[model samples]
Target: FLPLRGILPDMICDSKSYIDLLTIYQEKARKDCELVGNYLYDLLQKYCSKNVSSKAQLDDLVSIYCKNSSFLNVVRTSELKQEYRHENNESLKQYVEQLPAAQQAPSDGDQSESMMTPQPIFAQDCPELCWYIGLRLCDLFHEKYGRYPGEQLKDIQNGSEDDNSREEMDTDQRQIETDLHDLKLIGKQFLTDHELAKHQGGIRDTVLEELCRYGSCEIHSIAAFVGGCCAQEIIKLITHQYIPIDNTFIYNGIKQSTALFKF
Candidate 1:
């Protein structure tokens, strides 16, 4: 996992939910191993043709890869607005530019001179941004109810409740609905408490809904696929014979597609 210290603001990274967010996240699995394999094989052939054998040459290659591949680069690519491409390198520029005119960054004249509002790395419509916020909200939900979105109802069902009570409260359908509602509430409160509603607006409901519906379950196939990809990357790191992916890899199991984005 990449350190988020400089990737996100201290206010967010220091929050309790942020810690929990690290523990849980949308699975970013990499697929299409053959594509990566082919790419590596080509690079290896090129390397062999050059007859590069010096430690200095290898160190230069590793440095080049490290510079290009980073978690922050992927986040910036996915969340940055196309129009704001020129401002992408500005450290103080807000990552999310969807704030309403009235809530935008304060002008120099509006400053109190000693305090400034901390800028956040959230976007209203971006899937990557929503996933981060939703995961944190899920953590907040866990903090509040002592159960994840869908687990509360499961616990209730297993409790010593009478049949009538179980019939009323324990249905899977009802639990699904409950989970959705609770997650929405938690999401709203999170935005409000953090004063992000005025900045980036509410997170997309679809992201939260998906999280609630899926709960914490993992598809075994996806898990195995991720493990295999990670192992491959680790081997490449150890061997240093072929260039490994420079950063973010997204795999869609359903689509049978994989994309590698260099950060």
Candidate 2:
């Protein structure tokens, strides 16, 4: 069973509902099989940070996630199944540009950053690529493992509560507790090894080839590739602008490549 720490951060990092957000994202992704992208990692890092407040609203959390360039690229690339093109495409861009500036009121003559301040890219076109890839990953997990990652968490929580309630714990609770004991086991076993390996087998080399061919390997390399190829379809719906078809153009090209890999 995966622990809350294992997956909660990723779900909360997106602008999804915090209560059961992980389950929701997993379910949504499972149903759509798209919407998977780097936004999950971005959200995990932002919400899981030591200093960040845990009580952020969904929009605030989305704003925070959108602020980061990596996350924005993910969003731009991720795909969505639903078709929702705006009638006034130019108006959408203007509205995005005119989004209220982040409130910067001072507190006690010390300029304390407003918690709800929107990032420059928050109102920009949603990160369709990240969302699509993330969902696809979740769907892959369910198909392979025959269970959602969060189900293990629910089992752990239920087992722990049952253990706590019993005057003398039973074998079932003991077994459940033992099963849920090592949270990282799933990350090491499923996410890193199995899921990531499958993902790599399918697209990792293609992504690498594209990056190398373009002579740029910045974070945006993956973001833009994922965005243009995966997110362009979705953006067509949201913006209703006839985006010119891209012909294998790399957004952030770099010659050097990193050997270290982590999910």
Candidate 3:
């Protein structure tokens, strides 16, 4: 489960291994759900991201390859949304006193120059939030329609012999595209809709592009690495000892390389 994924991110972010993180993580995870504690062992093994009405039953599902476990055992969070906002906001506040003058915004109330802060509501570019949004879109589309975007994509490219099937596929393609368009509006609207993130915006288009590229594959090593990177940035923020990431970070596991971008 989803609940285990929530807790695992914290553990991964801390740079603790699966077995090593068991002690503290077990407690934190259990605190989230008693079923999580009961199923902690299996959850630590191979787990599925299936629908679970209850933690106990959710843990019971042995189907679906828990592919992420290796990365989890090696990789691997909550309402991903809530955890992300809280972590970013709390960490940024702690970093204010530590940042250099150039990094910090002027207190003179000048709106001419934009400001970037850890505050989720005030963040200029939060790839992490956008990342979650992309994943959410993937899940939403799949659940609403029985097929994935990728699958439909394949069907379209391959072409269907049956006119009815082909037409249906075209309809699916249009619907998915509409969903993507809605995602853009959702990102911008979310800021205005929720007074909390007012003007914050919904999500990023680049994030959406990435989700389309990757489709349903949930890469654990990548996720865990990102978690670690976030942890490091937050540490730098709290200690004010080092420069926190002023730009978004990108890692290419295929090439085993990393790059930073300022947007």
Top-scoring candidate (TM-score)? 1
Best by lDDT: 1
- lDDT by candidate, in order shown: 0.52, 0.34, 0.46
lDDT of 2 by residue, 91-165 (tens): 223322333333322234433322112112221122222222223344444566664323332212234455453
What's the true lDDT of residue 173 in model 2? 36
lDDT of 2 at 123: 14
Off by over 4 Å in 3: 1-133, 136-165, 193-202, 209-263
Please give the distance, in angstroms, between residue 133's alpha carbon in candidate 2 and its true position after superposition.
12
Clashes of 2: 29
Model 2 / residue 240 / CA error / Å: 3.6
TM for every model, in the order presented, reads 0.40, 0.18, 0.30
1 against 2, candidate with superior TM-score: 1
**Steric clashes per prediction:** 0, 29, 7
Please write out the lDDT profile of model 3 over residues 114-165, one tens digit for every residue. Answer: 1111111212233343444455455655665665444434334444488877
82, model 1: CA deviation in Å? 27
Cα-lDDT of candidate 3: 0.46
Candidates 1 and 3: which is better by lDDT?
1
